[model samples]
Target: MERKQHGTGEVVFNAINYTVFILYTLICVFPFYYLFINTISSNELTGLGLITFYPKGIHLSNYIQVLKLKGLPRAALVSLARTVIGTAATVFASAFLGYLFTKKEMWGRKFWYRFVVITMYFNAGILPWFITMMNLGLTNNFLAYILPYIVQPFYIILIKTYVESIPQSLQESAQLDGAGYFTIFFRIVFPLITPILATVAVFSAVNQWNSFTDTLFLMTDSKYYTLQFVLYRYLNEATALASIIKSSQGPVNMNLQNMQTPTSVRMTVSMIVVTPILLVYPYFQRYFVKGIMIGAVKG
Candidate 1:
């Protein structure tokens, strides 16, 4: 009887665990699943909220409509450039800064490090921050997206801790070989900390990819709008514009039966904005896991 009771309890426990895991996965995955189905489905079906657990009335018009939106191609190019360039620059800068802070010889290191960390907690308010950035010639410049985030304190701290774990003997040997700080950093330290650098690159790439506040405050021209910013404007105006377009049914060219709806266009844009980051994440997943594990080790 006890054996049977134990077996029953074990079965119940396994069932509960599996149930929770499936629900968790569905919770995480359902939004993207819904978005994809809606994007590929007919606009009328999407507008009717018919894309829940499964797709309905499939069509490619939503994707076609998205490509037709104004300034989108330019915005996409700008966002891609920003993500690549900005991520590269930020990783290098933060690693270098972090490496320097970890060194025994860096003068006033404690005070400087503390000051940088303080900026993480207490931001200069947006108005003042914007003014400062503009005064630094960031306004209307794509550099606005790249420069300010070059050496983020949070990333620097992570890298700094990771750098501290490197055997000091490596640096000592490099010093005996007449290596300068930059030489040791680039040749020796940089290669070994690939995990942390890859992790930081992921963070920087995501930030650059998703950023829109820079575009809102700094860029007045459509040429400089990032994908997220352009998409944001489209979202704000999409419903109203769609209503107008829907109402303007013509006898021949602009037929009501062939019209795309706002819902499908919005879902398509969301997929566009989200897909690149999603695709890139898997490539960095191993590095991210290793880096976090190593960084989590306490001094």
Candidate 2:
């Protein structure tokens, strides 16, 4: 290979570009690093909010204490269920409906599609929505998380734009082969839209995973609590009330005083909440970039 030489101007420009990118990367990653060091640091130091760059005291006790918190396991399970079920439901519903919109035989497609878009931009206030959820029996129910988000108009629009990019002849030929819309969609369309599907699935899963307000408002029962709500309550409420919150449904003797400092505990919870998405992101990173690029140019 030939050694390439850059002019003075090009060398200076490349140096500036690398410097900017390095700074941007550190800006994005430092908070997470701080959280990690603080979480594993001595509980007392963490509580005092003294941990800044590196851990002063390091041990696994903070994590152990957090894991021992009552009702935490159940709340985690609920969050997992919500993320998986909600993402699947949202992706399938949006893709199928979006595919239907691409069909010529669908009646009043424009108006119907517009109706979904309208709902995305407008909502009856919280009180009315709460009353509606009550009527639908979603209050205090696990279904509340999965049901309300099963059909997302923004995802549908993105999927619709994606579906429109596929050649019509392929679908027409499949129809001529006596295949129905469902078969064509599942066999011909779904496979080609993996990038967009991954993109939407990530979005749906993240939304469901981080959701806490829904639980706070709709879930009065302790059994219906989700992990995010548990974290939120811990961060905002006093530790003295932990025993009360943990056993709100029934009588139980418990002690939470020995739990790590609030900051350490908060860091632990942040790690717990964020770890799943971090683990899953690499698998979708390729699809995410591709989807955004294609959707931006075509959709």
Candidate 3:
């Protein structure tokens, strides 16, 4: 009787746990699902707020139409380029600096490490930062996207702590074998720090992909606009976007049911901005917890 009771309790506990997690998952996923359904459903109905839960009158025209918008393709390319380049640069800087900070032989090692870490505590304000960028000739330049993000204090700290967890004996062995610091770092240290580096890459990539504020301040040229900034413009200028869509399609194909509405444009653009990060996140998620725990907690 007691065994049966214990089994029953265990089943009940598992059931409650699963139920709670399922509800939480639904809460987290519902907004994305809602947006996706609205974008695919009849734009007319979606505009009226009738399409909820399951998609109705499903069509992919929203995505097709959104892709057709002016400057979207160019903005997408710019975003992709920055994400790839920025993530690579940030990871390299973090890893190299992390390794360098660990070496006691480097002059002013402690001072420099603390100097980098202290930047996290404060910002110099936007006007000063903009002036600095302007002075450096980075305003409206592609380097504006990549340069300032390279030496992130938080990422550097994570990498530095992670590197400290590595065995110094390994580096010493490489030194004794006549391998220089660069050789040891590239061949040994870089490979060994994959997990933490991957974590930092994900961070940098997300920052690069989602950033638009820098563009708002630094870029006066439309050619340099990023996808996120374009989305921002689209949202803020919905009427203009609608007019553009109509002008593109012309009067002949202007069917009321199939026509893209401002709501649809907003939701669709939001999904476009969010989709890349969602797709890329799963690839790096497995390393996220492991890297954060080891890098954060170990040291």
TM-scores for all candidates?
A: 0.89, 0.89, 0.93
lDDT of 3 by residue, 1-299 (tens): 46544588898999999999999999999999999999899888988999988988888878988899989999999999999999999999989998999899999999999999889998899899989999999988999999999999989888888888888899999999999999999999889889999999999999999999999999999999999999999999877787788678889988776687789889999999999999999899999887877856543
Q: Whose TM-score is higher: candidate 2's or candidate 3's?
A: 3
Q: Rank the candidates by TM-score, best first.
A: 3, 1, 2
Worst 10 residues of 2 by lDDT: 249-258
**What lDDT does candidate 1 reach at residue 83?**
93
Q: Which lDDT value does model 1 have at 276?
A: 90
Q: Considering lDDT, which of the candidate structures 1 and 3 is the better prediction for this target?
A: 3
Model 3: what TM-score?
Answer: 0.93
Off by over 4 Å in 2: 1-8, 241-259
lDDT of 1 by residue, 1-299 (tens): 36544588898999999999999999998888888987876666667776677777676656765776768999999999999999999999999999999987889999999998898889769899988988999888988888888879999999998998889999999999999999999999999899999999998899999999889999998899999998898788888656654554444545333466777657788898999999998899889778867856766
RMSD of each: 3.9, 4.3, 2.7
What's the number of clashes in each of the models?
A: 0, 1, 0
Off by over 4 Å in 3: 1-14
